[model samples]
Target: MAYTSEENYNPEDYLKDTLNKLDIGFVKVSNDDIILNHNLTFNKIFGYNHEKDLFGTKNLDYWLNSEERNKFREVLFKNGIVKKYITPAKKLDGEMIFLQITFKLNKNSKGEIISSEGIFIDVSERIKTEQKLKESEEKYRVFMETAKLEDLKASLYEKDLLARIFMDNISGFVVLLRPSTREIIAMNNYAKDMGGIPGLTCYSTIGQSENPCPWCLSPKLWKTGEAQHLVVDALDVTWDTYWNPISDNLYLHYGFDVTDQAKREKNLKELNQIKSQLLRRASHELKTPLVSIKGFTDLLLKLKTEEFQSKSLPIVQEIKDGCSRLELLVNDIILASKLESSQIILSKSLENVSELIFSAVKVLKGFSHARKQKILFDLHEEMFTMLDKDRIQEVLTNIISNAIKYTPKNGTIKLKSKTSKGYFVIMIEDNGIGFTSEEEKNIFTQFGKIERYGQGFDVVSEGSGLGLYIAKKILTKHKGAFG
Candidate 1:
């Protein structure tokens, strides 16, 4: 009833209550082997009626065989503890029963064995299950050892098959070299097929005086611990060679001719760069002459302001119009160069989309006026977003300028900005052309445009074929949405 122990505590009532209510077995005795305690588990486990029936009147060994009693005496003398062990008991009805009992040998103040206390469990089923588990574990251990040996045999067979095929049928020169001494050690059938001279090394076959050529992949193998792949133009054989270290001493080298592929790729890249450069150069150069013509035509308009003659104004406007076309050619080239050189960095800012468009149109007011193209902005003033102001302006300018240059006079170039389907949409509409579906798809691909068509003026000025490509790259970097 009370859980704490005071200095003046008593325990006779507490012990009786616990023994009567709990499922435990215990016994107490004096130095002369007289029973003092017994619990319910003892009665239920061995078919005893009451503690008095098996107490001081009987010897404790009456429940154990002579051999087991001797074992208990010897173990108690040594360890003072006896684990769960089987014992035989004789019941009053003349029936025999078996018990799994554990015992603790207790000593008195004289340090002599007095009586014993113990907690015993009925583990007949548990012991049987444990024995079965022990047997199963041993069998599984044997099975695992056998499976491992079979796996090793299968792995070795696979390696043997690969080695045979590699040696006999592999293409090109597969030579093994000793890096330390720079000597030829082994060669596959392909190596022999290419040049079967004995005592000749990879350096000799490739016409290199040095053992490790400048493009040799041996250094990569040493650094990364993996096969190194690359193409090289050897003095004697132009091929794509893959190098690997088969072991610390032996290097495996193999390759085939790639001269035609190399030549085509190199020439194509150079041609593309040249064309882009022309677009940039043409745009920069034409700016000066166009400025001169537009400036003079404006001077003429200002002089005739008082009595503006419509007929003469139209002729003056025609000259200004020609200058505007030249300016567009220049703008396209400059935009293309920025895209080609990887110099296009889109800067992000929190600003109104409408404001950005208006400012760009203001900057290009003269060009738009000369072409008589109407610039209309369709954006809600309250709508704002985070974007690179200058970059978005440039994109808008490119689309609108192109429309102004290609569309007929008095045509409308509408600039619309709003959100659609979770994206901040910016659309430039012109009757000119919306980049046909096919062109739209490939427009952002670099060298992709050159794969279609750069540099220089009013006659046939085209882009370096990298503006849309570069714009695409920039938008991709910014994670901007594009349809």
Candidate 2:
């Protein structure tokens, strides 16, 4: 409908029409926080079917926090108006939305508040957009920083190899290229001898390809501005290829023949396989005889006292101890071989850590008692986590037994456990001979035993040196750290 003229226009009708057409929701609430009247936009904004569904409802019911309504009223009363007050509100469906509200206190002539009139715009989408933009900016900033670091590393490496790269008599081939066009800009005598020259495309000159080589690293170098290295086979020769970005448009390419190195690596891998097989075989063969020797030694020790003299009895006990130590060594060798070959699989379950620690201490109690040492425990009442029960117990036993062997007579060993930063941590402390910094670095390696000088106490210094190594591997498999 069209208005005839200004003479026929009604101010109330014009205002109502303008408010109804606006995208914002408008509401008039009573002083008691009850909804008095609202526009069609208000009903839609609050997920109502019509104005009747919302009329007579408490305006405070839509506020996410009732205290916010009181604060809003206080602000309106103090200034008689509020503008662009942003807050969270709940819709009819209980979905939280951000709203930007502007309201004014409608007062009578006596300065008594009557009602409040407000317009609110849903600002949830705008808030979400701003958050996404902020995250994108952060990611871009990180990428630029990483790129700059890579460029600096490339510059340093280029500086170190400047003489070798520029000399024509160098053994390896070196050339400069335009990454965008794959054009060779310059080449040393070594590269020239290999049929490469200026004004020729690298892929055609070296790769003998009509198109760009599939293994070319120029594209990746251009993006990351970092050096790239790979081995490629062309012209019946294996080239250890390297590409480094000199600038945005220039790239340094160099490589040497690695055919001999490749052959040696293959031979070394075969030798390792053979070594592992021999170790497994030897461990298996030694295990059966060692078990028999231990069994016989135990039987002799249990024989009647009248059958042997007291001096012979001690010798029999020594034999049993030697057999036990050998058995442990054989077992460690087998386990190490399995670990190196990736054949060890962990069986995990929820187990009580306290119980596992207790069991380990029980197994090593005899050894500690023989040394006149003390073993103390400081653990939680019941701590449960997912781990391999037998494997974890083995780790605890090995570490505890090592503590017993290294500590002096009458020394105290304490085992403690606690949870920190989402991880279960166990610490073993002992008044034992510790390691030097260099020895500590190699302690976790296979056969990396500490060397001792003079010792007064009769401490057990003999071991296969594989205890800590195996313990470390087991803990690593359990996603736990040994140290």
Candidate 3:
């Protein structure tokens, strides 16, 4: 059982040499707590350079206190062995590290404990890593809890701000009421201005009643969970009221004041009635005088009195012309009013389209002669359809007269008639003083005028401005398309 090493050897020495060659540290401590033998790794683990450097100088008890050493001995004696026994120990340099050791009891042949042997493994790095991981998890948990509380607080603040903004900026009166007692719980400024108050019944405040009004809708809303609506008249104003249930026993009451709109509509109706009466009376008062003036002028022109004819012919003609213009103006105003009121009923019948255009041309030819303008007619595919002959003639006369009035002395007015797509189309075009695009848009609108001087007249002349308006309405009644 002995091995020769320079003539002084034993099995224990050979075992110690073999243990030192391996990575693990080995220790043998005798009874009485004296260090017997240890490997070089054991010395290095405790910050010593060599195995001989840690002999009996410091026993295992030196690294641990008496209490922990006794606990280690008790466990070893009870279990007969200790595996992975982790304990805190001090190094030779006075620094602390965690260690794991497995212990086995070394006994003699008589069963008397002699010494203790164990394996030592450094676990300081592993312990430090685990401590750091635990600390990091604690920090993260605290941060998440704090962030959650802050977010909840911010959300509540945002909701409160939005509710206040809505209540203050709303246009009409608004109130929140408790359905059972009809108590006003919340209200906006407009509601307060209308005598609403918290803890007051709506029937008492708004309806001036000792009890709940019969028209109060909160009871119905509580039963059906649906909104109710009504109209109320108070303080000379009309209110459109609505009741909406927001919660189990809470209802929203809102109303709009419509007094001003109603008054405006009533005033417009009265004004229209007065306008119709005035036009009717003016038509009668003006037409009679115009007819007599034209009649006397015609009678004087036909007289055989040579003295009167030579001296007063031009004067009579001037008076007759003035009467004719006045008559035209009155007629246009009356016709435009009738068209607007839908009073002009058409008696549509078959008519000669060509004859209508020719008659209009013949009447306007004298005006064209005075202006030295030529009227050219291009009747293409003349056909008859259902039309009011008088109205059609009036439309034609207005269009041709407008052309003569606008055209220069030598400008030619071209009147064309054609049938296209089952409708008769008439186009009256003149080259002199044509309207701009902007003017053309409102040309057929009543009293819509573009400021411009005449092409050949000494001064600018804008006629009644209703000529095209009346013509357009006539075409509209006949369901005829025009531009």
Candidate 4:
């Protein structure tokens, strides 16, 4: 076991030991194609029990194709070496496998060919993997090229293959049917779980009916040759379904269960109705008390008593202002509720558009005067339109008052009227603290108040935030638009 250099220093034995330990097969072949020597790995790679079983065997006999072996030798001799040349070869039992051989010719000092030494690696698995990948690519190419409905119908094998590929990957119930015969052709797992089976009538399997369901869209689909969509309730489930015409006879039906969604929608509707009713009731309750308080405050202000005028007049006036603001808030809430429920009917009449604009300006003149703002009107004379005078005046009041309130002291508000394309257009422009882009989106939304910080201007910014909302709704009812 322990040998010094002088005792066992054989170079041939050292080389064979080194070659046998390598994982790759090592082979030396003579110029006449006979294998001169091979290692243990070579024996294993060629399914031989020992190197003796392969010694002196013709290397060309191992190649599955003799022509390939001839070509490999021709290339090796011409180039004096060949690296990583892949060729099919057979094992001892005649099983074919691919090999990657790297070999080079060994030459004597006179430059004459002597022998060739090479390593062999089994590359059969790699080749098989590449072949499978190529086959998969071809299958995908065919799937994409024949994806049309007409093409799918032309070949039954392609139709079934594509349908299985398409249906298995989606998360919903899907079924293919013959609409004319009412026969089910295929169904996905989801449909199968619901008792769907091919070759059965769709009405019997999916609809679970002895006869065609009255809501079946096949008749309509056949007539129009168009896809139809419906939300149907069946088997205690709600489905949002689409029946698409694949051909004159075939139909592809697909949908998802919407039972929970339908229930949530019903609940939301009920909650909205309750909210509207509560708002209307609370607003009416607040309006009654506000009207009584305003009536009493006015009666107290009218008294000419010296004690009341000197001591209580300012306080009573404050109470009246508070009452007025409360009344406006309550009225806005009531109007918003009505608008949401679509309960408002306009009483329209023929009226002068200029006169209506003037009436709104006159109502807000005192407030603008107190802030030292000017209202300029450029009205067209004899401009008449069939509109609800009271409702239009309300809209004008909301816009003009907002201008007066938001504009700084000593600012100008211009009202211009024109007749264009059968519309009596009124434009209200003011130099006010304009809304930012973000704030403008919420301007006509209920309770979407644009909060303002004091900027050293006499501006009344407090509001119920429903004036624009109600105005927009009224304009919409009048078949007009607001921006």
Query: Over the stretch 1-483, how does candidate 1's per-residue lDDT look in tens digits?
Result: 564765443444545444444444555544455666666656665566665455664445445466766676576555555666666655556556555666666654344677776655444333443454345335434543654423222343543333343444443555655556455555556555555333455556544557565435467675665788887666455677767665565565666555654654464455446556655665666798789889988887778655667677777788888788667657756765766666667667888877777787888888878867788878767557777877777766655556675555666788787777777777777765334554455556543331211122221123434556556655666687467
Clashing pairs in 3: none
Score each candidate by Cα lDDT. Answer: 0.59, 0.75, 0.70, 0.77
Task: For model 3, state the Cα shift of residue 111 in Å.
Answer: 99
Q: Each model's TM-score?
A: 0.37, 0.56, 0.46, 0.56
Give the lDDT ranking, best first.
Answer: 4, 2, 3, 1
Q: After superposition, how far is residue 280 of candidate 1 from its true place, in Å?
A: 2.3
Better of 3 and 4 by TM-score: 4
lDDT of 2 at 356: 92
Alpha carbon lDDT of residue 376, candidate 4?
A: 91
Clashes of each: 3, 0, 0, 0
lDDT of 4 by residue, 174-242 (tens): 787776677777766777887777778777876577677523655667578688888887778887777
How does model 1 fare in lDDT? 0.59
| TM-score for candidate 3 | 0.46
* Per-prediction CA RMSD (Å): 39.0, 33.6, 48.0, 31.9
